[model samples]
Target: MTHPRPPRSVLSRLRSQLVVSVQADDGSPLRDSRIIAALARAAEVGGAAGLRVRSAGDVRAVRAVSALPLIGLTKTWRTDTEVYITPTPGEARELAELGCELVAFDATRRPRPHPVAEMVAAIQGSGALALADVSTLAEAEAAMADGADVVSTALSGYTPNSPRQEEPDFELMRALTAAGIPFFAEGRLRTPAEAARALDLGAHAVVVGSAITRPDDITRWFAAALRDAAERTVSPVTEAL
Candidate 1:
């Protein structure tokens, strides 16, 4: 049986929930496919509201394992491309083939491989919802102008900076509160407290990663602590030998 697509309720839950991006950037796991599946299933079992999967293979991996509604993103590097998620109508169609209910893409001031309106039309043409990943009011407005189903504050401080990754500015979130579309607080949210704060400020959803599903970062935290402790542990050279 086909699962029902995630509704606006997912947006509402995003206010205080974590949507795990279980897939890696390479679109292939260094481990096994079952590892990704277990991670996604564990997230859902542990109360994650949804899954934001990258790549078609990762989507396929998670789809068979977890019943969580998926928000799919396909990352293709095109020389002329500035946007990644469903950058073209073909990518959008690919998302639908993989059973993505909602497709997200960059809706910034930069040029997109596929124009915003045309992309929206294509997703609509395919009967899937479109999500606008924007960083500012103007971008959000432009996406709304293009008929986006939901507006996300995901890429807010990344692009236009060039070379450095910055956190989402609180001012942008404040500005987005009045945009008349569902507001999703994404990127760099470090803890559950921050998630609560975003929703309290009227955000529709808050997408968090690194802190949850990315064990590499978390493991580094532990490794650094061990390194520091090891440094502090003094032993007589002869005894140690």
Candidate 2:
């Protein structure tokens, strides 16, 4: 059976644009779908061209609140494997059925219940493009071969095999570009300059999350910076004492 091509309007609309990831952690105060919807609306008003939302309920909430393109995903933990992002075909299919334009799934080399190709086929069968969340160039290549429509640099630092970095993984972006793989710059993109730099490094687009949606994370970033500054400015005599 053949599936129709993903909506071109969505794909074209997201090109060279900012896709905000509005996700609240497990214990976050703003974990409710209503809050997420408000955040999505705020992002749209603030010029975000698209949204990368987690959970089917969140996707539906965001979709109801904005006309922006939506990329949906689910984070599930399993003791058997490390591939938590959309780990199963059922999750991918459900997200697609929620009217998301794209469904993001883990396309890494980690152990998973379903093959990456099966997940991709499931998303396409539901009329959504499959965006592969990859950590390495090899994973990206494999995802493409497995029929992923797009690759995102989402799992680079999360995976044990990929380099752990405080900043965006420009090396991975460069490698993907060199391999002629178009990808979305996603992980650790904390600033406008960093996002722009990713685009300059050949990212198809950029997705910003904690920096934009998680106020707690942003507050911590500021607090850490202030602490570092205070430590750096401390007097030599005080340090000696």
Instruction: Give me the candidate number with maximum lDDT.
Output: 2
**How does candidate 2 score on lDDT?**
0.91
TM-score per candidate? 0.81, 0.94
| Candidate 1 C-alpha lDDT tens digits along 61-127 | 9899877767777777778867766688877767756877677777777877778888777765665
Give the runs in model 1 whose Cα sits over 4 Å from its true position. 1-16, 27-32, 161-166, 220-241
lDDT of 2 by residue, 151-232 (tens): 9999999888899879889999999999999799999999899999999998888999999999999999999998999888
Provide C-alpha RMSD values for all models, in order: 4.3, 2.6
Cα distance off (Å), candidate 1, residue 44: 0.4
Displacement of residue 17 (Cα, Å) in model 2 is 0.7
